[model samples]
Target chain A: MKCDFCRETSVIHVRHTDKWFCEEHLVASVEKKVLETVQKTFMINRNDKVLVAASGGKDSTNLLHILHKNFPKVEALFIDEGIKNYRERSKSFIKKFCKKHKITLHTSSFKEEFGTTTDQIVKLDSTKTSPCSKCGVLRRYLINKKALELGADKLVTGHNLDDTCQDILMNIFQFNMEKLARTKSISPGFVQRIKPFRRVSERESMAYSIIKGFESNEGACPYVSESFRSLIREELNDLEFKFHGSKVNLQMIFDRLVPNLEKKVMKNRLNKCENCGGPTSRKVCKTCQILEQLK
Target chain B: MVTLEYPDGAKIKVEIEGSLLKVLVKSGENPEEIIVKKDGKMIAEDYELKKEDVVQIIKVGSKG
Candidate 1:
């Protein structure tokens, strides 16, 4: 097979666009898409200090690489949930990659900040809550705190097309319109969040990682099996298989609907958490509340 | 003849020269999770196969 753009052999076939690309063209296309997404969404400004949430996974590794290459000032922030074997192994790759690229890397751990790891939290809670539910709260809290302390203008995440589509579907399935609206591109009282790969597929990210020789962590989190997001991801993948471009269309619908939903949901005033002074809609932040439960 | 390689390192040889979709269907592989690439370039399903073309069908999706 030949590349659609040239006589060179094709390396990637994007089904939705019915295009073939050579290695050079494939890399160009992926980078162009990322740049386009960031530009069209107004995800970043020329002088912004971007803090990338690097997980050492394929998506985050790719995100960090793309952002560092394109942006003027970029740094990596990693939240270590203290998952045995997983966190340690993932951090090593993050450290090496950052060092190799000469990008500044900052890390915060649950053990150091909260005096407890996710593993211990899981074992100690009598409610038997899903580990992901607890882990996500703690990780988000720490990430936000670090981003703020580091004076980042925006916090960039590795959320790809599949993940964003799954999240929209999950919220719709649960009929949580408020939560869905909060997933919009910009929100108040929080460091702006951006997803440059919001239009890129997970497979595309993986292929890019392999082609670029990024030392991405290949292991899965131990608690992922019990998360509802995993189930939604599987279902979305099945739907995308049955109907090509389903994920893309889902994200498009979400993008169009978010503005209207935000108008309705934005009325709920956000308040500062008395404990950590973080933005919270309730009397206490979710992170502080979770910490209280642990205590 | 065209060669299709799966993620498991299994290879299937096809004598037919047609689009990537036809090749995938002939190989009995699910097109959803499988992406076809030739010489490390992603090809669309409509890409016509030429003789001696070696294509890799990578299985891609969200990992746990």
Candidate 2:
């Protein structure tokens, strides 16, 4: 189909808007929305030490590239979860991308920080402990710890509109009101998190990476199908298919509810986990609890 | 006869006469999660299939 704005053949069909865009316009559209997201939310300052959580996935890779374009000093952090044949490939891509762009990148690992790899954790596979669960907790813990150590003013992620919608739906279904409220809430000893792609769709992010010639099709986590989030992702995609703009609508509803939710849900004041000195609402943080279980 | 090409180099031959979107849906693929290409150029979902047309289906962001 022809691009709505130009003579070039359209490569992207933004369903909700029913608009077609060529490569140039597609990039411009996604970047414009991201820039607006950052500005509208007051997400960063000119001198902020911005660190992007890069996994070499389409989302993060796109995020890192976009942030670096706007903020030349933006660096990236990669966490090797030690997944066999998976994390390594992603790390290699991230390393090459950083070197090419001259952006300093930081590296951490589950092996170094937790004394165990995700591969090892899955082998032990306690009946009550899902490997995905452990990996999620540990990954979040390490990212925050690494971000804090790097003295990053803002920790940015590649979370897109579809991912954000999935998270909101999961939290609502699980009655995780506090978890939802505290997702972006400021707390001591933690780097503030921001998602520039929160309003951009996943497919658009993939298209941007492809058009930029840096998209990696490999490195999908082998155990992704085992997670509850995968199911939520599928369901949300189907809903979005049946009704365009469903994901954005869900985010709009959640955004309106969050101000009140934040006020109502911060009752469990966070305390430092004695073991890790991380912020936690409980006596011990979920990361510490997961680590103990692994042991 | 139309040939469907996947990124993994797998090809499937199907005798279908409809829009690319319909053929994809019939094959149990989600239209939202994929982009189709003809002659190395991206094509819209509603692009109609021709006899013996070979189109590349590049799976997009979604795992589904």
Candidate 3:
């Protein structure tokens, strides 16, 4: 496939947009969006300590770059999910990137903290579910915990527009009304979780990375390569090809519908988990359940 | 174990035991807003405790 920008025969067909992009353009676009996100919402102070959740992927790698470009107080927190070579390599990339930028990077391992990696969790389970669910819960808990541990005020995530859209689509599909209500919105907790790249597209993030000459691991997680998210992405990609600007259109539609959606679909009283007392829609929060499963 | 009620009169007679293993109950209810408290120190319903645990469950509602 010819790249949309470079017209190179070697191109990756992004499943959400159905556009083939050369590696360079892809990285450049991602960087641009990342920059835009950071500029719009993130106001950095000299004394502020920022904790960035880096996954060694393009989105995160570019986020680190943008944060460093505009702010001086950015550090990274990488949670090693204990996925064997996959995690080791990702961790190494983070270490190298941190060293190059001279940013203080802190590392946490699931094996050390929880006695398991996402791979181990998936291996021990028979459900064949995406480890992302477990990894996500662990990652979130640790991110918040570590952010507080490191005395950081805000926890920045590499969630881009496509990620947000996927979540929106997933919530809609699952009838997750409460999650739908807070889609793309930020809230505070013990540690504030913010997405500077929430408005950036995946493709744009990739492009931004290339333009800035940042190196990112091209390897996808072995388990996530065939995950349901990718399948949904492909489905969305097909839709976008049939109707250009579907993502933007979908975002518009969601923006209009979410007010009513929150009322009609998610009007149920919000609950606090009895276990951790965190915000939950059920009696037990998802984090406590995963911890229960691990135990 | 305490018998707590939902707004729809859905009462769950739970026995708070020794150790709490968090369980996500299947319901049309929002999981985040379900309040679990025992003896004025908030706890999950699955919290394993003694025999005489005073548990109260609260639900979020619209003020307007």
> Candidate 3 local accuracy as lDDT?
0.65
Query: Can you give the lDDT of residue A126 in candidate 1?
Result: 86
Each candidate's DockQ: 0.33, 0.46, 0.01
User: What tens digits encode model 3's per-residue C-alpha lDDT throughout A1-295?
Assistant: 5577876643334444556665566666565655665556554455678889998887777778778777768899998877776778778888899999898899988878878778778878766667777787777877777888899976788776667667788877887777788654444454666777766665555445544666676466777764667666656655654565677667768878877766665555557789977766679978788878766
C-alpha displacement of A259 in model 3, angstroms? 5.0
Indicate the residue-level lDDT of A268 in model 2.
72
Q: Where is model 3 chain B poorest over a 10-residue stretch in terms of lDDT?
A: B20-29
Write the residue-wise lDDT of candidate 1 on A1-295 in tens digits: 6888899877566655567677777777778889999998788898999999998888888888988998999999988898998889889999999999999999989999999999999988989878887888888888888898999999999988888987888888888777798887355568888889888888677768767878877666888888788888777767776677888888888788888989987788788889988888888988898899988
The residue-by-residue lDDT of candidate 2 on A1-295, one tens digit each, is: 7899999878778886788989899999999999999999899899999999998788888888888999856999999989888877788899999899888999999999989998888887768444677888889889989998899999998899988988898888889888899876888878999999998898887778777888453445787777788888878878877898888899999899888899998877789898878888888999998778777
Candidate 1 chain B TM? Answer: 0.82
What's the best-to-worst order under lDDT?
2, 1, 3
**RMSD to truth, every model:** 3.9, 1.7, 21.6
Which 10-residue span in candidate 2 chain A carries the lowest summed lDDT?
A: A215-224
Provide the lDDT at A223 for model 1.
Answer: 81
Model 1 docking grade: acceptable
Return the interface RMSD of model 2: 2.9
lDDT score for residue A287 of model 1: 89
User: Can you tell me the DockQ of model 2?
Assistant: 0.46
iRMS, model 1 (angstroms): 3.6
